[model samples]
Target: MTAAVLSVEKFTVSMPDATASTPALGLGQDIDNCVPFMTVSSDNEANEAQMVDVKKNGGTNKFDFTATALGARDLEVTVVEFDPAQVTIEEVSFTLGSGLTANVTVGTIVEANTFPIVYAHSAGDTTDGYDHVMMRATFTSTTNLQIIKQVHQADLVGHAYILEALNGQWSIETGASIPLAYTTAQTTKNAAITVTANRTGLWSYWDTSDIGDDPRDSIWDGVITDATNLDLTRANGSTPSADGDIESFVVNFAADVAVVQQGEFNYVTAATKTAAISAPGTLGNTMVVATNAYGWCESTGVTVARATCQGRMTFNSAIEVLGTRSGFGNGEYRQNFQVIEWLIGGAAAAAEPIIIMLGY
Candidate 1:
């Protein structure tokens, strides 16, 4: 035998305050404060338009037909058991919108209240099915609140309204399950490096001066002679033979010597020259050398040299950066059911209607 699948296993009803400033009925509410009741069964009557056929006296065939206008729909609920101790008798005795009207007691009117109601269905014995099915409606005690006492149980009957299409009196929605979280992949880009400077200088010297004195003194004198020259070459003394004589000079500079070198050089003097140097264009006469001298140069007004590198940014997919997800359908539908009116009353016997209708 094939097993039958039950779409709805059970149902629940929630009641909300009708006296709220903006009373929203039949969407969802906190059921913790509501009185608990066991419902035996429930049913509904759509009460759609009724068609009337018109026939002509001259012919046996059918003629034109007209349909009666649609009216309010009905939903009946049969409750078998409820807790009477949870509510006070004085609170249930007064009927809503009836100026505290009282009803004739058959045994004892346990409870009564007027409010908007929401009906929800639970999926039973199905994995791939709707999550919830909710419907909105209202109950009034002036028309249909019935109570009957049996041997051990009392039956309470009430009616819900599905009024006009303008108010959206009755609506049912089925919600499907959807995903909540998503995963996204992204990519990083490569960085670039940059270098900057105010000026660059290169200096080269070929030492050719005598070892007894500082050869760098001639480079300093030459720098003083031409402070603005970018490429300056200067020698310390005249050319010497293969004897113990050292020659030194300096070359290129991007800026002025005083600006690059900052100041003059201070040196310690030697006791005597290692070898006496003949004066230029003199006959056998020797020139005396005393202290040692040195010079150094650097570029000026260079605040920064290099800059930090930056990388190009990329993404694996457009959706990753856009924050859009895939494989999930539309989410739940949550529209509150609108209620026009609410009524509350008590019934003497189960045979009589719980609600008494004064007029349509």
Candidate 2:
């Protein structure tokens, strides 16, 4: 069914009835004596379009009225008081209802609302100033009433912030804060929730969840951590329609884990110990008793092996080692020795697992 709501915007307009230093009631001096006609305008100059005065409620000193409203943004209201001889006026302040909310208030003046409806004002004197109870009407189409009502029901499902995982799974933390979810402020009619992660920009409607039905009906980001046991710091957003009102997002970074400890160490490998102990980084970096025992001493001495030599010796289990030890065989004792140390993920790839000893 086609339906709409009239958003009420009200303000009080008053001018000094009779001032001590002011002119007495002659032709058009005193307020009560003169026929005071008040009209709303959008500008302070009293030279533009006039406002439709909606005598909404039974408010005397106050000009109570409702204008079809739009999104919450900026609005200016001008109040014009006219008589044969105008009266000096000040600012115009307004109060909004329901979905209609205002930010700043300067006496009897403000910027345009979601829509611009300029009202003119005629001041008796520029220094004295002019005032009028002015506000614009902004008509906005709303979602279906059935769905809207269901949203505010006592049993209505609370808002949510989706914590998605890398695996395309998600977990829903309701009644909690969600980041980047709400593009608008929370209001009596609707509320917003944000879901944000550092480094990764905004994801799809897809989210990983472990609560309520699978949420399979809608698109979701995947792979979320278990509920009630994750980082559940939620942040609130402006009012967001549960319906399809997509808001853009900015790319921000969120930290998953901080560096706890960083360490570097040096060790020795097997093949080096037996061979003539070529160029090794440091002994004890990593020692192994391969075909021979006594890893440390027989341990490969200190030498920094190159990339190719490091790998072949570490994983190949055997490498040709030439030694001048005359104790076992002929003049030069050349034999196969296994690698004692592995250097992995070095400055570059192809490196074996290096000796990484942790420190306090």
Candidate 3:
């Protein structure tokens, strides 16, 4: 019968061994917190395959045979093959198209350079071989043999130096910072004619003398032979013993900066110091006076009264105030009021009928 000319496609079924059986393997379901995941790289790109949650307590759940036919696919299985091995989720291929395109910015690198000092001093100015850098400084001294010293460097904010001994034998050690030096009575020891801004500080101890000498009275002079950031207070912050211990303080880095607008103090409070008046003058209290009393509320612990506001402060008297104004930039203070424009009525006045503008 010619064996029926059969082309057989054999299907073999292997019976389980005589032992415990293996559980069925999960297909598309994921694993909890994923255990023993496999990572592989194809073209410098890596992917992972892990366990997935199937959400089945070994129940007859319908399995979806859908496959990820697109980008960056990862495969995971929840259940391991134990008994009744069945579904095999072999290889998972991905097509990561336009998924990870990023715009990276790369910055260019730069290098640096250096420079030199514009004002350096000289070295060695003594019989005792001590190298001293030199620079012209403005210094001031007093006749009180107890001469007050001041030091002003070209670079005020640069270095902190002091002048210990002024004129050899004068054993004086100056403070590092300059105490403010403004007074009703200017002092001989105040900022000198040749030396202003130069204050003194003996930030360090000197073994030898660099100071020149005193000509006659406790009166003396100094040769700003040195300039250094090393405690070189080359000027004096002292008020003449004559100026009283006027509680000298400094307009420190903390002190309010001079606010300049039309150049003035804003909340300026000036008074004629009437040995009998009270309330502050409103901005309109313009009763033309005789002189310009450019008075601002300045508390001079000690009373400093003007002889009289009669002649100096009248209808023609003028004043101005400047302080920080908004719509503007910096905190400023300037002389907005110059007593020069002061005018008492008399006849030809701008604010006719002598309208006086009081307390700027």
Candidate 4:
């Protein structure tokens, strides 16, 4: 048994009024002012196309028509419906990145729901006196949209910007645009940072959450503190070229903990006095046994045990005779002996300073 099902498809067309013409086969026939008809075809021979009467739902628009019951074999539904005259255009205003504003409105019939189409506009006379700018409007929210002007510059052309829409919000995705002759822009600013010696050039951050898992899913520079924490900042200049897509991370010498404290001593691993030293108050009073505890040392860049170190240091045991706190060997010091870790014990004592003691 051939199962039968009914399907409906909607088409929007911008049709003009038909001209009055007589057919050769008919004699003295006045077939004038009749509505035009569209033929619907199907790929499967077994399934026949059904034509339905077009009705005007209280509107004078001629493009308003519906096709009903496009029949086909069970589970085999393939139909073709197209109208070339249905495209239209409207004007809209939007802002650009370089503090410029422009607009474009595209009117096209699409089979599926999508964001409103916008196009680039030519340079025009404005109060700012800007010219030859390519601009695009994107919906920032369901009710809000942005008009961004593309900036142009030398050697930084051909950078592609991808736009992705989600939940009615439009965002310009980040990534290296593929190579092309030149990039079109609406603003007159460099779109990318030029490469220089010992300096990294322009680059985009990859957002792994995009629809296609696109690496260059976002067009921003960001820092990742953890798996869930990401802070994105816009590029200072033009978007980077495709050559700058891959990631090259440089360990900041100032921020790198390892480099900053590479020469520091390990207080815990250093040998400590057999007995806990009492907190020190006076100088050269058989310095009280230091609380050789495992923790970070705040004394940074201090010369201890013939080594320079910075940042906190964890000690496996109490530091006794300056065995080694941060890469410093036993009995080495830049300052007087027993000055580092010299705890001034009192009821209202100040914060303990992570001091490195001079070796005897």
Error of 4 at 22 (Å): 27
> How displaced is residue 318 in candidate 2, in Å?
32
Q: Pick the candidate with the highest lDDT.
A: 4
Winner by lDDT between candidate 2 and candidate 1: 2
Task: Estimate TM-scores for all models.
Answer: 0.13, 0.13, 0.14, 0.17
Ranking by lDDT: 4, 2, 3, 1
- Whole-model lDDT per candidate: 0.16, 0.18, 0.17, 0.21
Candidate 4 residue lDDT tens string, 1-360: 111111111121211111111112111211121111122222211101111122222133222222222321111011111111221112233323334433333333221112232222122221111121222334333334344433321111111112221221111112222111222221111233222111111111111111211112212232222222222322123232211111211111111001111112233323221222223332211111111111112221211221111111122223232322224332222111111121112223222322222111
- Minimum summed lDDT over a 10-residue window in model 1 is located at 305-314
TM-score of 3: 0.14
Candidate 1 positional error at 181, Å: 38
- Candidate 1, residues 118-181, lDDT tens digits: the string is 1112112111111011111112123432211111111111211111111111111111101011
Best by TM-score: 4
Residue-by-residue lDDT tens digits, candidate 3, 1-360: 011001101111111111111122223323211111111001100001000111222243221111111112121111111111111112111111122111111111110100001111111112111111111121222200011112121111111111121112111223212232223233232321111112211111111112221101111112222222211111123321111111111111101111111111222123221221121122221221110011111111111111110011122222332121112211111111111111111223233221212111
lDDT of 2: 0.18
| Steric collisions counted per model | 16, 81, 72, 34
- lDDT score for candidate 1 against the true structure: 0.16
